[model samples]
Target: MAIDPKELRRCLGHFTTGVTVITCQGEDGTPHGATVNAFTAVSLEPPLVLVSLDRRSRLCGLLEARAFTVNVLESAQKDLALHFAGRPNQEVRWAADSACGAPRLDGTLAHISCTPWQAYDGGDHVLYVGEVQQFHIHEGRPLLFHSGQFHHLGGDHNPLLWDDSADGPDAGVSFISTLAGTRRV
Candidate 1:
């Protein structure tokens, strides 16, 4: 049976995600950005991240593989997100260079500077993987998207710590086991 696109979309909407603005210098030498939620860290060792963009998006055309920045939006920047997502709002407030010379927005949670590493075909979307060059992080809660609406994070944090020799959860250690037994520093 053929799957309906709307049904697929609704199913995928169950996953909560962080909002981001993928910014890059346009061919005209001006900064251009697109609001996207399809952004995630691809690797940690080489510092890689991936952003998926619609093939027909104007921002996709404006984007150059190398030299782009991912601005993780804060909850306060919902207007900015809507602006870049095709609803022009009031003037954007861009922050000056702190980590790299990429155009960044004020009130963002973090800025990730990247150079293109690879691109892959993703049907209607193109997955662009980038090597993180530099980054700046501000202390704040990130803007979140879920079920076609915005959400905020609840105050819950993991208090677990692992030793250097520990291999994380796959190392056969459970959270309850750690609390019940002596933990390695």
Candidate 2:
């Protein structure tokens, strides 16, 4: 016999994911969005991303062979995430992306504008892959969700805090040291 669906869902919930609001316009150009945590980067060379949408969602139908924007939510914008998830909150901010004409929500940590590339059947969800047209990564921590709860970054170590790291910018392996000024590795 097949495993219990609830058990499978609980197992999947162990995988942490960043929150996103995938936005696209209707035939009449009306903006529409839905909170989607099932999103991931598919490729880097051509810059592609994939987002899974429920088969019955309205936005899912509109995205067929259409352009869209994926707004990776910041931790402070959790209410906006709830709004897109069908709980309509008080504050909703959106602006049109100049490159793709897709709606990108403000206060998001990052945004990716894309053109429809391909679609795959995913049992109960449609996996839509898009070719990235433009993207922006602003300064903010991304909103995260895991085990049905909202979460924030847990690590204290930031990789880019130093102006010059040995393996990063400096040639001949040089680094900016706090004690001695410049150290060569």
Q: Who wins the TM-score comparison?
A: 1
lDDT of 2 by residue, 1-185 (tens): 99998999999999999999999978998888999999999987789999999999999999998899999999888888889999987767777563888888877899999999999999999999999999989997888999988888856834433534455445565555554355444
Query: Candidate 2: where are CA atoms >4 Å away?
Result: 154-185
Most lDDT-accurate candidate: 2
Return the clash pairs for model 1, or none: none
Tens digit of lDDT per residue, candidate 1, span 1-185? Answer: 99999999999999999999988877766788999999988888899999999999987776646577899999788888999999998798877743545577777899898887988999999888888888889998888999999887767844455454545546665333254565533
- Indicate the worst ten consecutive residues by lDDT in candidate 2: 157-166
Clashing pairs in 2: none
What TM-score would each prediction reach against the true structure?
0.84, 0.83
